[model samples]
Target: MMLNDIAMIAIVGAMTGVTTVLFGFGGGFVVVPFVYQLFLRQPAIANNALHIAVATSSAVMIVNAGWATFQHQRRGNVTADILFPLTLFIGLGAVMGSLLAGQLNEGTIRLLFILYMLVTIVDCLVSRRFLKGCEARPLSMSTTTVGGVAMGAVAALLGVGGSVMTVPLLRRHGFSMKHCISHANPLSLPVALCATITYTFDGWGKIPDSGFIGYISLTTLVTLVVAGGIGITISQRYFPKIPDWWHARLYVLLLIAVLIAMLW
Candidate 1:
């Protein structure tokens, strides 16, 4: 790699590290936008690169989520009973999502991404109502399966980890935020791994001269992983002190910003 490449890696690493510490899961959001901007300057890497970028981001998430789960589990917050079945279905869903993404058009994919983010913003805003109802009752297998399927579909469509959806669903099902995050941390591993593998294999024929293995971008992947590792360490230590309302407002603003950028 050239010096410029090394410099880019350093920058991405630092950004990912900071995001991991602050949000515990903003690597993709950070890397994707930053990379998209970088590719705009080098348009040769732009075409079909988004797919590779998303795949690499997911692959990095597998490692990031594993480390995060360990940290959360050490705190005695992860719930195995809920995570097992949910993970199984989420993995399956991720595979299907990757396949679908391979077949979808770029415009369609972009629109879907925006729509999914909007839905997440809506969920964050109404989370209290949903959680109140969930606290009054437990989610049945059918409900859980349905939720898992929807999350998987959206994740595949947008190349997100599905945790934003998963966390909210868990909370609505009466699980506390801490427990939900703990279990979801491990659960995201399968989602990212499955999706990454599928996307990598499925998009191989499409990506060219992109330093990719399937849809995985080595450049972005390396930077994101390094940065995400740092972020995970911080979130694990300070996450508990952060309020849920603040997180919701942040999500709302992020969604709005993404919407405007995509539309413009």
Candidate 2:
């Protein structure tokens, strides 16, 4: 990579780190669209540009999630009772999804990603109602597996870091917001790690400028990891003190930015 590439990665990393800290979601929901636009402006990458973007985002998330999970665990949020079994299917599903991503068209993937983001926005707006009926029931092994599989598929397809769905699902199922975020952070690590590994295999021998294993650029990954780690640590410390209305507004702003990126 050139000096310009290093600069770009650092800039992207700082931005991504801030977003992950504030939102508890990986930056890919923002990063992939931005990367797509960047590629459009420069045209250095090939037609499969978004795939590389998605893969790279997932790769970064693995590191970010690991850091966040550790802190969350220390706060008594992560429970093996909830996390262990889910890993089984989430791992497999992410691999399958990454393998499939290679054969899909960029336009189709982009549109689907946009649509999903819109739905997520709507869900965020209506989250209080959606999260109202939390009941902490003991999850059967089957139900947990199904949920994990579904989450893994979506995470691989969009490189979304897994917290958006995981948080709400956990909340609706009776987990507190703090606990939900904690569990979700660790859960995301497995999904991101699996997807990154699978995407590496699928893109092997073809992906460009991606440094370490496959489609993720090493410089980009390291930069984001550092920024995201700091962001998550700080955010977790201060998040609970933020007011609810402000939090709502933040989510709205995120949705608007994501929508604009998708449309652009």
State the weakest 10-residue window (summed lDDT) of model 1.
18-27
Query: What's model 1's overall lDDT?
Result: 0.66
Q: What alpha-carbon RMSD in Å does predicted model 1 have with respect to the real structure?
A: 3.0
Tens-digit per-residue lDDT, 77-143, candidate 1: 7766787677777777777887888887666776777777777777766767543434535557875
Model 2 weakest lDDT span, ten residues long: 239-248
The sequence of per-residue lDDT tens digits that candidate 2 reaches over residues 158-210 is 88867777766665567655566567667777778877887788777765544
Question: Per-residue lDDT for 121 in model 2?
Answer: 72
Error of 2 at 241 (Å): 2.3
Question: Where is model 1 more than 4 Å wrong at Cα?
Answer: 1-26, 130-137, 237-240, 245-248, 251-264
